[model samples]
Target: MNMPLELCEARDPKGLYKLARAGKIKGFTGIDDPYEPPINCEIELKQDNGICPTPTLMAGKVVTYLEDKGFLEC
Candidate 1:
């Protein structure tokens, strides 16, 4: 899953980002620590046109990829 930092921050359901921003949390992934996206990933789910696709759509994409690559037999 690859979402923008701002979107992730906005959707901070656990408020970890807030705590990380306030220095309460240390070594946070994106707040303090670096977040380097994978250079070569098999699949990447991201937002399109500033709108995130539903979970069903995202899972469909992954399933399709897997089937194409012969990872899923069914």
Candidate 2:
């Protein structure tokens, strides 16, 4: 459901609006409704860079966490 703005603008608003009215697509963000909730109103960011541990490390942590929670087979 996430799409870059350039792709959305390329379709032309008038055409996209017509498509929405015709029900060609459902839940079109930035067109049918507000794409995201108010900034900083509902969610909080812990870091500005948004960099977390590497993917492999993250995956390992997830597997470990799931195992600890009794959700993973191994």
Candidate 3:
């Protein structure tokens, strides 16, 4: 739970979270169903001071690792 549900509500008073909570939405992540994260990931980027890393940067890091490890060449 990066930001708690209460915090989400606080951030967006008219968010769809209320509908999700009321079970009006089906198969919502972290609500009616558990979120299944990827396993055996090659790279896991840690948040920098609560700031998220850009997806492009993360992908570049993974590509660099793969290239260094001879898993990929491009």
Q: Please, what are the lDDT tens digits per residue for candidate 3 over residues 1-74? A: 23344545655566667788898988877678786767776666655676656668777877898899999967
Backbone clashes for every candidate come to 0, 0, 0
lDDT of each: 0.93, 0.57, 0.69
Candidate that scores best on TM-score: 1
Superposed on all Cα atoms, model 2 deviates from the true structure by an RMSD in Å of 8.5
What's model 2's overall lDDT? 0.57
Candidate achieving higher TM-score, 1 or 3: 1
Number of the predicted model whose lDDT against the real structure is largest: 1
Go through the candidates in order and give the C-alpha RMSD of each one to the true structure.
1.5, 8.5, 5.1
- In model 1, what are the clashing residue pairs, if there are any? none
Q: List the residue pairs that clash in candidate 2.
A: none
Worst 10 residues of 1 by lDDT: 3-12
Name the runs in model 1 displaced over 4 angstroms.
none
Ranking by TM-score: 1, 3, 2
TM-score of each: 0.81, 0.32, 0.49
